[model samples]
Target: MDIGSEYLKIVIKRFKEAKVTAEKAIEQLTESELFWAPNEESNSVAIIVKHMSGNMVSRWTDFLITDGEKPFRNRDDEFMGDIQTKEQMMELWEIGWNTFLNGLKSIEEEQLLKTITIRNEPHSVMQAIERQMYHYSYHIGQIIYVAKFLKSSDWKTLTIPRKK
Candidate 1:
């Protein structure tokens, strides 16, 4: 395959891995634990998931033709910790990932060099993909950290154990 095709495949794989890692961490938490924040200033796992899902939906829907920051997206509201149940949180997560993954899969090799706008700022398709990948990775790390803290002694290793 050409480099562009290879790159797309690799990005998809990495995104999937990130999603699974976050979900594994999330699975270890109770519903109440998902909404636990260390302090008033910090966000709960639920808030992070809400923000990530909102971001994904806004950035991925009509990704090429429209600006990534959709007019309807209320980024501020995503941090409000509105997700009340595990089912609701998972639903939002599925919607966001489905929109993003489907959009990513639809890109053609030639489109990689094309410019797109996010909040009216120009970015090459490659740059946009890289940008979201980093953003999601950062949030997923937060989710994992919070899960580890909440689970304490019960936390299962998502990867190889520290000593192993």
Candidate 2:
């Protein structure tokens, strides 16, 4: 495979890995725990999921032709703790990943150098992909941290145990 193809595959694999890691952490939490926030300023897991989903849909839908920040996206509303159930949260999570993964899969090797706009800011396709990769990874870390904090003694290590 060419370098572009290899790069795409790696990006997909990394994203899938991040998604699974977050899901594993989420599976350990109760529905109420998913909405728990340490402070008024902090976001709950549900809110984070909602925001990610919104971002994915806005950024990935018609990714090449349209701006990454869609006109219809209400980024501010995503932060509201409105996800009523774990099921709802999971549904949003799946939608976001599906949009992102499908969008990534659709890219051709030649498109990697093409410029795209996010909020009217120009970025090469590679740069845009890396941006989302970092963004999602950051949020997934937050989810894992919050889950660990909530689970405390009951938390199962997502990675190898500290001593093992």
Candidate 3:
């Protein structure tokens, strides 16, 4: 088997699937619901979206040429939930996802073995991609959870509905 090609295909497929699930979950939330939190320490969907967008844009913007943690990123502010509306959140989300997907598409099979840095920690390109994939998926799960909690019985499932 062509391992590199198979790996690339699998990563791309998983990224697309994750994005679809997150978007579907977001669709069930209204503007108010997007910013609701269960407690002071908990994150709202808006905050999670902000953090994910910030992380994606920072990590992927100059992905191969520089460290994944961009100097200009204000990581702390991402949790503040300052995004005033769903439109703002969606715009940021689209920008971040586009940056990430485009960056991923630009990688060549040979480049996967090249080393990259995130917060000065060295990682292969494949490792970095995998890291972000897991990170984004984790936060997306949180977004779905918060949205579902806010929507209560009205929440729509992003995947196959439970068979009762």
Candidate 4:
């Protein structure tokens, strides 16, 4: 199996789909609903959005040169859930995703073979993309879970219908 640029594009496609899913899940929520969490240890939908945005920004921006963890990323604050409006969350989410996609779009095929330092160890672009795919998928699952938890009885499926 020869993996190449199309593989990267596939990852991007998944991210796009994941983004849409996250958005739809949040669309089901109200401002008060975003604050809903079943337990003291669980995260609210707002907190999930914050954490996902924070993670996206940290891992995607300066992807080629810097460690995945950015100095500007506030990992702790992401769990605090102080943001009151969905608009604010969406803006941050869009910014983070745009930055990530822009960075990914900028990479050339040759650069994909070059090693980039993620934490302290070196990872090829393929490895880095793989790492991020799992990471984002993990958080996206969290967002979906929180949304479902908040929606409870009235939850609706967000997946688009197949054309006959």
Would you estimate the TM-scores of all the predictions? Answer: 0.98, 0.98, 0.95, 0.88
- Of candidates 3 and 1, the better by lDDT: 1
- Between candidates 2 and 3, the one scoring higher on lDDT is 2
Off by over 4 Å in 2: none
Can you list the residue pairs that collide in candidate 2?
A: none
lDDT of 3 by residue, 1-164 (tens): 88887898889889989989998889988778888887899888888888888999999988888998998999999988689999999999999899999989888999999999999999999999889888988998898888787778998887778993
Which lDDT values do the candidates have, in the order given?
A: 0.96, 0.96, 0.88, 0.82
What TM-score does structure 3 among the candidates reach? 0.95
Residue 131 Cα positional deviation in candidate 2, in Å, after optimal superposition: 0.2
Error of 4 at 44 (Å): 1.0
What is candidate 2's lDDT per residue for 116-144, written digit by digit as tens?
A: 99999999999999999999999999999
Pairs clashing within candidate 1: none
User: For candidate 1, lDDT tens digit of each residue in 104-151?
Assistant: 999999999899999999999999999999999999999999999999
Candidate 1, which segments miss by more than 4 Å at Cα?
A: none
TM-score (C-alpha) between model 4 and the true structure:
0.88
Q: The CA-based lDDT of model 3 is what?
A: 0.88
- Model 4 scores worst on lDDT over the 10 consecutive residues at 155-164
What's the distance in Å from true for residue 57, model 2?
Answer: 0.5
- All-Cα superposition RMSD per candidate: 0.6, 0.6, 1.2, 2.8
Number of clashes recorded per candidate: 0, 0, 0, 0
